[model samples]
Each structure stands twice: as C-alpha cells, then as structure tokens.
Target: MSLILKDLTVSAGKRPLLEIPELVLPAAGFVGIIGPNGAGKSTLLKALAGVVSHGGTKTLDGAWPDAGRIAFLPQDFTVSAAMSVADCVLLGRREHLGWRVTGHDRAEVRRVLSMLDLTPLSDARMDRLSGGQQQRVLLAQRLLRDPRLLILDEPTSALDLHHQLEVLSLLKTLSGGMLVIAALHDLTLAGRFAEQLVLIEGGRVHATDSPERILTGGTLDPVYAIRCEVFRDRDSNPVVVAHPAQGARAGSLER
Candidate 1:
C-alpha cells in the first residue's frame, strides 16, 4: 500500500508551479521534502492535502483517499482568540463527532493533549498561550484524528530547539504506523530524522533517495549554490555543514 501520483501538476495563472509525472510514496515512513526557498515544496504538500487546486491523479493503495482521513497542518496556519485549548483540539474529530459529544471524543482529545504536553494548559484560552504552545495545540488537533496520511509544513518552525527535537523524534516514531510528510529547511536535521528525502528543484523532484545519498555536497551544491560537507554522527546519522558557494564575488565558502 502506497500513495501514488500521476500527471500531477499545479499552475499559477499560466506559469506552472509544480509538476510531477509520477511518484510513489511509501505507505508508512518519514519522508522529508528538502529544497531551497520557493522550490515548490509547500506547493507539493498542499496539492496532496487538497488545499490548492491542481491537476493530478492521486491515490492511496490504488484508490482515492477519503478527505476526512487525512490530517494536514500548514506552516503559517493560525487560529483566532476566544476558544479553549481543549475545544480547539476537539474540532479535529468533527468528522466522526455526532450531535452530542461522546466519551470517546473527550478521551481522544485528552490522549493527544498528553502526547504533546498540553494537558497542563488545556483549560487556557488559545489566544493566551505562547506561540510554541499554540503550535502544539494545532498539531494536537491534527493528531486527534486517526488519519491515514499526515501532511505538515515546517512542523517545528515555532518551537525552540529542545521542543523541535522532541517533536521531530515523535513524528519519526509515529511514521512507523502511517505516512508522514514534512517540508524541512534544516538539512542536517532532515537527514537525521527522515527515512527518505525528496529533493525538489525548480518545481520538480530532482531526486528521491535516502538522506545519506541526498545530503552529499555533490548532490546539494548545484541546487542550493553552497559548498557543504556531510559526515556521520555517533548514531550514524548524516550531518551537513554548508557555506556560501564560491564565485568571483567577495563572499565564498572558506576552506
């Protein structure tokens, strides 16, 4: 069982924003979308999540997916004030919720809140919470659903370093059960957590390979215009260190 895409394409007016003739994503794994800014990483995720209009034949397990069964959290997604944290997360279960709230609904909300360390502030208002806390609440909302596909854009963008590491670790663990796709800017971190990496360039997939293969200087230099080196850590994860690419200009990567 895998997510299959065929003839997928997105256009902004007449200029094409993204195009993927064919792609197959593993059913359960962490796949990181890695590329420079404006490389169409977000566009690709939005298309799969149905947040944007695009032309494509996207199927899960050879069949069309149920919209309600997919959980999506955009990078800049925000919520207004005047709502309790618990209530905000509970909204995620709306597809399965009845006219009356069920014990199961409350139980599920409690579970995700605990998973994201939000139970202590579950009663507080969403507007009163800190940015990191608010991000966690939104993530908890998405996790409350028993989704088959989980799509996120910069899932750790709002969190501090410690919390970012914690959430990435959790997402990696969860990917063992369901598909998890995220757009990551930190090459080292992406290499460490992602089982596979989709390297996007100029609105198309330049490469779909393991982080070890995609994080090398030879692979990234042309795309990012930087000179970088890749090494292994104690845990055998790829670690990337990059600098500005060399040219006739004043700024260049140092030796």
Candidate 2:
C-alpha cells in the first residue's frame, strides 16, 4: 500500500509544475501537501491520480496500484447534473455494480452518507445544497470506493471551521488502513493532524518530515517568503504564525 515516486515530472505546455526525484509514503498515515498557491500541490495529486499526463514511475507496494484502488477528489466539485445526493454517492459503486445496484451497495451508500452527516440530505438535489454540503456528499461518494489510496485537493476549502476539523478528523481515522494524501493551505491544521508533511515550492519538494520539523520559520520562510514563527500549543503540538516581514521582498515566491 506504500507509494513510491521516482523521476516524476508534471508539466503544462513548456513549464514544469511538479518534479520529484524520489519519495516514499507509508501505507497508512495522514500525509499533508502544503505550499503557497501555484506551488504545484494540485498538480502532484493529479499526477498520482493519473488524471494528468506526466513522466514518472509511481508504484504501490512495489507495483502500480490497481485502477480501482485509487480515488481522487479534485479541488473543484462543480457538478451540473442536478442529481440527488443519494444518487451521486451511489455512483461510487458503479464499478462494482452490474445492470443494477445490489442491496449491499445501497447499504454502503447509506452508511457513508451517515458518516458524512448527509442522511437528512439524502434526497436533496446536489445543485440545491450549499458548496460545503455538496463537498461532503462528494466525499461520501469517494469513501464508498473503499480505495487503498485517497487523494484530495483542497478538500476543506468550502467548509467552515467546524466542518473542516470534522472532515480532517474523519480522514485521519480513515487512514488507519490506507494512505490519505491531501493538499492543504492551512499550515497550522496540517501540522496538527498530518503524520508527515511534504512541503512544495516552485515545483520541487523543499522538505519532507514531521510537522515539527517542517513548520518552523527556518523551513517555511524560504518557500513562503514570509516571516513565520513556530511554537507549541498547550498540547505541545507545533503552531505556525506567519506574517509578512518588514521590507520583505514582494513577489519573491512568484519569481
């Protein structure tokens, strides 16, 4: 269930978006991909999910992951189908179902819906739900896949603080038997939850380690081009506070 990448490169037109010489991720843990915007976080996830064309060798457990073993949730969950929440969630079972969805599939959908607190909205149309609620429904659909590897891009962007914690906590629990990789912008939350942090900058991995090692100003200041202070919370977990330093170079990260 481990993921290994070698000589990986993802490009758009002539500009490379992501490049990794070599990296290995464990089978079961919450891994967070953190970086400033346009740092190729989404591109990396897309490469792993096989949604983007790239040059690399990505193997799972010493072999390529099965097609059905990987499930991905993109940053944008816009769906114009007007499908019901239940129906959208049930689509996860499409690969497993034949002409008709079996009773087991239906039950699984219900279970996932309950887990995501979407039972009340089961019959609600996707277009009618708020952005956050729609995101939850999409997540329920992905969870129903029972994937060996789950990749999410900006999964909490549409949720409130309460729902953000809830979703991340749920992902942490789900990582017990599978790999969960998420691209996150909230460095504090990433530090608090992720077992490991992959810091990306300018299409390259700047660092990879525990949150305590990667959240510090020394490690992050270069990538983000901002002054950052890393401290411990009451629970002794690393907390990062970032602000622009006086006379800081403008557009440094962009260059």
Candidate 3:
C-alpha cells in the first residue's frame, strides 16, 4: 500500500516549484516534511494531493488508487459556508452517498464529530467557528473519507498548544491504519510522531531519512542558515533549538 512518486514536477508559469526524481513512502506510517520557509514542502504535499498541477506518476501498489481513498487537507482550512457542522462533515462521504441521505452516513458523522471533540458544536454554523475550530471540523471531514493516503499541509498551524498535541497524537494513531504525511514547523513534535522525515530545498529532495538523522545541526543549519541545537525531551524526542548563525547580524534571523 505504499505510495511511490517518480519524476514528479510542479511548475508555476515558467518557474518550477518542486521536483522529485523518486520517492517512496511507506504505508501506515507518519512522515514529516521539513525545510526552510520558502522550501517546497507545501508544493510537494500539494502535488501528492493533486491540489496543484504537476508532472509525475503517483501510484499506490503500482496502480491508481480507488476513488474516495485519498483525502487532502490544505493549510487554508477556512469555511465560509453557512452549513452546519454535521452537514459539512457528512460531505466527506459524498462519493459514496446516495441521492437520499442515509442513517449510516449520519452515524459516521456523529462518530467523527465525537472523535475530534466537536460533538458539542455539531449544531453550530461553519462560518461562526474560530480558525482552529474550522481546522478541526475540516480535518474531521477528511477522516470521514477513510482515506488510505492522507496529505496535510501545516495541519497544526492554527491550534493552541493543547489542541496541537491532541491533533498530532491523534494523527499518529491514525497512521497505524493509513499513510499520513504532513508539513510541520515544530521539529520536536515532528520527531515525536513521524517515523521518517523528508528535507526539501529549492524544489528538490535534499534528503530523506529517519527523524533522528534529518533533524540535526548538520542538516538544518546549512539549509536554514541558522545555528541549531538538537536536544531530547523527557520522552527522548528530539528538541530543536535555533539561534542566530555565528556570523549573522542582529535582526537578520527574523524567520
């Protein structure tokens, strides 16, 4: 069930944004894509999600995936629709839904709402929810799709510390049954959850390996142009601490 990408390329106008000669991602595991701010992490994720035009061959087990089996959640999780939470989440199952709504679909929606702790807000309007709340709701929708390959862009960007940990923990649990790839800025959290990490820079794959190997000063310092120190938390997860590079002038490390 692994996903394999070959000769993947994404371009805008005449300039290329991402290019992957070859990449193999294991099935039922979590992968973190990390690099500098302008790196192609988002572009790579978007290409796999089919959100952007790309030239490549993405296959699951050497064949195209079945419909409704691949779900994507981009960084922009805003919802201006006037639909209720329950109604909006149910849309995830649209590909399999019938002309008439069924009890089965409603039941699954309720299950996902409770999974993301959004049951209390089930009756609320999508437009009235906060940014973090909308992110969770849309994520629940993607989960309801029951995808085999899940692509997420900066999934934890809009949440508080509590929800960020909660969501990452939940995604780790889901990775046991589906492939989950996310672009993350939090290196410590990424090390804690991702089985492997992919470092992208200048529209190409710079390196791909275990989190321990990729989240190091040797890898990040040159790519980010900043001094980085990798430590370990109580759980032994790598903690990344960044500082101004040795020769960096004051206020030059504003990223």
Regarding lDDT, does 1 or 3 come out ahead? 1
Clashes of 1: 0
In the predicted model 1, the residue pairs found to clash are none
lDDT of 3 by residue, 1-255 (tens): 677899999999999898899998886689999888889998898788777899979987778567588889998789999999999999999888888998988999999999888999999999999999999999999999999888899999999999999899999999998889999988888888899999998988899999888878778887888877787888878888889787854322211
lDDT (0-100) at residue 133 of candidate 3?
92
The alpha-carbon deviation from the true structure for residue 220 of candidate 3, after best TM-score superposition, in angstroms, is 0.5
Q: Positional deviation of 13 in candidate 1, in angstroms?
A: 1.0
For model 3, the stretches where C-alpha displacement exceeds 4 angstroms are 246-255
RMSD of each: 2.6, 3.6, 3.3
Clashes of each: 0, 0, 0
TM-score of 2: 0.94
C-alpha lDDT of all candidate models, in order: 0.88, 0.88, 0.88
